[model samples]
Target chain A: MSEAESSTAAQAVAPVQVHYCEVCTFPLEYCEFGSSFKKCKESLQKEDPELYDKYYSDEALQAKLGTLSLEAQAKLEKEAAKKEAKAEAKADAALKKKLASQVTIKRIERNKRKHVTSVHGLEAFGVDLKKAAKQFAQKFATGASVTKNLQGQEEIIVQGDVSGEIVELIEEGVGVLKGIPIDNVVEVEDKPKKKGGD
Target chain B: MFKKFSPSTDISGQTSVKSSVQRSLRTNILSQWKVDPETFDQIWPKKEPITLVKCREHISIYQLHGEPLFFQHYDGPLFPTLRLVHKYPFILPKVGVDRGAIRFLLAGAHMMCPGLTSKGGYLPPADSGLPAGAAVAIFAEGKEHAVGLGVLKLSTEDIKKVNKDIGVETVHYLGDDLWAIQKL
Candidate 1:
């Protein structure tokens, strides 16, 4: 019985095209339950007013109140509003923290004349450390890998002293390095102290 | 099952499935799901090899070009990802909960019998009632698209008769960590 149904469905039906809300990524019909329903509604109203009306207009709201009582509907609205505010505050805090975070590129002296550049704190800006290391390796033709630093945080270690070039690339917003603010990128030099002299 | 998944920390490894394994998997999926050959092909092209992303625990996610299509826990039934279910809703049998349960469902709660047996809810007739342990697309009252996916803990008739406790154990839902991942 199932086989026959599947064969007919295979011949007759096509996949449904679901339209998702850009703000919350939920289907437009389910946006009311999303944390950013107000933003989703606003964006939908702008992008597709017809759809917005179909889902959000007075007639639609009346029809949607099917078995749910008025008291329950009012409570749901209040809860949704509270959730939206909380989510908005959380997003604001995250953005502020990201903006305040710094990316440190350090040049460490390995020998008398050799140096290795280690970039720290790029992950805070949402950069993929492995992909960034690969990009650096390909761009400079040198070995680059993501490794844990002494602080137990992940950092990209490039085999050459290309800290200056890396800074320039970050400032230029090349590839995955985009969206990192130049003001937060600081370059530091670390040299071993000479024991006998002092 | 995918309520708290993080790819970087949770995924153990990813490997491309061999042709023989892929063939068996294809047959398993065809038998398990209600999808047809053409629709299945549209979701997962025949030529493209699927990558098996093994996560912590025994969960295995099958991905086509970084987009997760379906997943399974241990040897349980193969459940399509919520995103895939949204695109091809008919792939699974549907059960709907009432509007009052929508908020709790979004919070990753299991579907209680009361929510399913309510006036706003819907269930298949006794003649076509689904058996226990069946994968189902969970829809909400007055909503056009599915909001989650689950496995029926009890048969549809039993759920109507019992009218209490959890009816469907939620495997994936809207706003879950899995749904947040568009690509991996």
Candidate 2:
């Protein structure tokens, strides 16, 4: 189609908002189409009649286009804003929750603290195995309950009210040896949920 | 004086030789790697063919100091050749290692290939180490060699953010249960 014809077709297709002029390709806001864009329309027709005829004028072409009504557009924008606000609020809530739940000590001191420990058997498997064990230990620590087996081996039962965070801490302890990465030392003992509701 | 009967013990020595041959055949047939029946037959044309059944019958538990000893599988003898820990050894989730944790990595290293060096991956400038949601650092013991295994704690959200930001599944928990900082 001719440039003018194409431009007209474009205008007919979507009348909502045009950023750039279909003909000149200059930004519509910069073009004469600012405030009351109707004047700009007249100016365009006067400036380039031949160009306008090729693209913009005539009812010969059927502009088969869909557009959101003002109400619909407004509703869409409102919904978008609501979604954004909800996301922001959720993020804020999460941050606040994190801050609130953090274990704060007036002073950081090293004191030997004792808790029930369940250390997994030594596994010669590679780092992946260690990581897997760490994850399992974390899961076991948080969600699962713990019991002592007849054989004296501590058994961690990942069950009701158990969480993933507790398991993570347990795994962290297991992965270290004098602050070095160690293999397969997941220990768990039944205790009250440390933080966060079960 | 030494035994003067050379011929008498000579035949016994031959029997001992036969026992050694039998042991050799047993080891070859009973070991993990199995040779083709045709090849076995060809190799032992003169001796009786030791089929899988015969091999099993000949197998004996080799013990050392009352302990059953098996061959130690070695990927390689050198520490450098040895592969680091697999995807997941212990069950930890969302665990990540930071530059500080990477005391194992060498100090002076240059970018060689993809993933090996931070030069190409989304490693942030040397000031604060790479930022969150950056690409995975695949260090191959370059200039900054990893001295030992370094551990880092990461949360599930952190992992998800990294994956989402990187536009790919870079870091994944090899195991269902993931170990994190909490337990550490």
Candidate 3:
């Protein structure tokens, strides 16, 4: 038998196990569980087969919650849509939070002809400072290392005015694409870049 | 007597390599440098197009869409990132020269054996020394910064054997056309 077919059978003495909605298999909070029903599908359909059948044949779930075939379909659709929208917003906020975690890229003037570029705060986003520093130094073709800033936080220090390059590297997702977890979202408001592409 | 230094003029200009060559060059160079391939590829991805413009018998200037990226010196394969040693110090073996020799070196003079053997001069440990014909970062004494790239005609042992003068026959010194040619 297929996996779904096999899941239809119910067992006694069931452990307090989590069950999913049969139709969608959505393990959402709205889904309920118990014995003689392996999943919410069995419970909901067994209790109301006509409702389930009509709901599947419904065109849209949101138009009517009445006795129309689309009534339950509408509710399920609304539930799924609300959940999807909430999840989307939450993900967007989380990404914004991660990006806004102060990925400060600074070009400190050390002396005449010797500038130091420091990329700080990326470690909060799960970037390995040493690895990121090596990539930066290699990209700009300069020397760089993972050193402690005045705040004792780990930062990447490179030996040049790589402020421009550092920003581009981040914006272009150089470190992020390499599993840095900066979300790889492009910042639309980047200052006019001088280096076309390096 | 110090043999007068003569640099081979650049020829065989502006040659493009296929994607295969670029991939191989990237692999070969990073391997020779003992760098992790994953990290190097992540940094300098395969998508970037590189052009090899021959600058000398042993060296070529690598360009990315006509913008020079680096100068590469070849022994068996490309050592493209040698020019970036100021940022990555351990890329090559380093030898320090007296402060007095800095001016001559930057003026594109061939580093004499005496310049390296004289007071204030330094040579890398013979055992751990860079093999002859390998790339070296020539740093000046006290300043402790690389002045240029050079290839040794004689190994550290050979330099000691010839003891009175010339340790390395300079390949590309500071202020040379290659150094000033590309702003990489």
Candidate 4:
């Protein structure tokens, strides 16, 4: 190797240099266990602007937070406020127009002698299945279960057709219980009572 | 090992849902699995609604296209009908075990960690660190077939620490109620 390269190599072989905080002289990494980085930055900026400026480099990726003029900054803040207000209003309107959501309840004729009432699409109203299922089973005096359908969607299944009373039950209980939206409830099946054939 | 399994109760009712209900159910399923909502309905396809019933002992009975498919527990994991496993095993998370462990797995005994930490069997990704109470499908080494569903009793780290018995509760074995649910 060249003489200069050999000298640099020897230097590289020597003990690794330890970096310390510019303001406190404490090691930077271990600062977290001590006063921390923010304190050091604040102290440097307050006590020694010249050192802080010397240490700061705009070219560094960390130092690249852009500075905006007062008017430009105000305009951006106003736009953000306006967008947030619009979103809040949109949510309020959606919540007010609860009847507009796509929710459907179906009554399935399970077999020859029995009826299975399935309440689907209630998730839109934020209905908790376990509680709802238990309530339905008690209300109708039939077994009820919260289960995922073929498509992995959660639905409440109650034994027998309480379809007519079920809708009213859900609507009335919506307020007392958590998360059953009154307006979002719709019955897709309203068929007349079937003959109790064995 | 088990001589018999908990049985499935036949659903007392019948259901024929609407075309719109079917459409929304498809959308709901796709959304739950986080598949693209915009994917064509024809690609996923629609089928006749299944016969469902509440199991007196378990959560409920599941039938797909009018055939009994799965029996899920209320507070615990599901006992999948082998017919369901026979069709779609890809969707399940899996654990591997050696040929020696396969016999115990079929007889419905819990899978110990010894097989998994040994020569033939291997672990799932260690970085994720399989947590307790998570369900996994057991697939035999070399056979490449899912034998059953299991619930981990302990965390993967704990399993690695102890080299002996009962790492996972065998929820649904190949020859258990899940395997026989299809015939009924």
C-alpha DockQ of every model:
0.55, 0.01, 0.01, 0.01
In TM-score terms, candidate 3 sits at 0.41
Which run of 10 residues does model 1 chain B get worst, by summed lDDT?
Answer: B34-43
Best candidate, DockQ-wise?
A: 1
- Candidate whose TM-score is highest: 1
For candidate 2, give the docking quality class from DockQ. Answer: incorrect
What is candidate 1's lDDT per residue for A1-198, written digit by digit as tens? 354365555364566689999998988888889899989989999999999999999999899998999999999999999999999999999999999999999999988789999999999999999999999999999999999987899999999799999999999999899999999999999998877954
Cα displacement (angstroms), candidate 1, residue A125, comes to 0.8
Task: List all candidate RMSDs to the true structure.
Answer: 2.3, 31.5, 30.3, 25.3
Highest lDDT scorer: 1
Candidate 1 residue runs with Cα over 4 Å from true position: A1-12
- Per-residue lDDT of model 2, residues B1-184, tens digit only: 0112122222121111254655664454434222233332333333542221111212222212222221111221111100111211111111232322122122222222222222222322343343233223232211121112221222223333443222212221111111111110
Clashing pairs in 3: A61-A74, A142-B87, A143-B87, B113-B165, B113-B166, B113-B167
In angstroms, give how far residue B139 of model 2 lies from its true place.
43
In order of appearance, the predictions have TM-scores of 0.94, 0.18, 0.41, 0.40
Error of 1 at B152 (Å): 0.9
Overall lDDT per candidate, in order of appearance: 0.92, 0.29, 0.57, 0.59
Supply candidate 4's per-residue lDDT for B88. 42
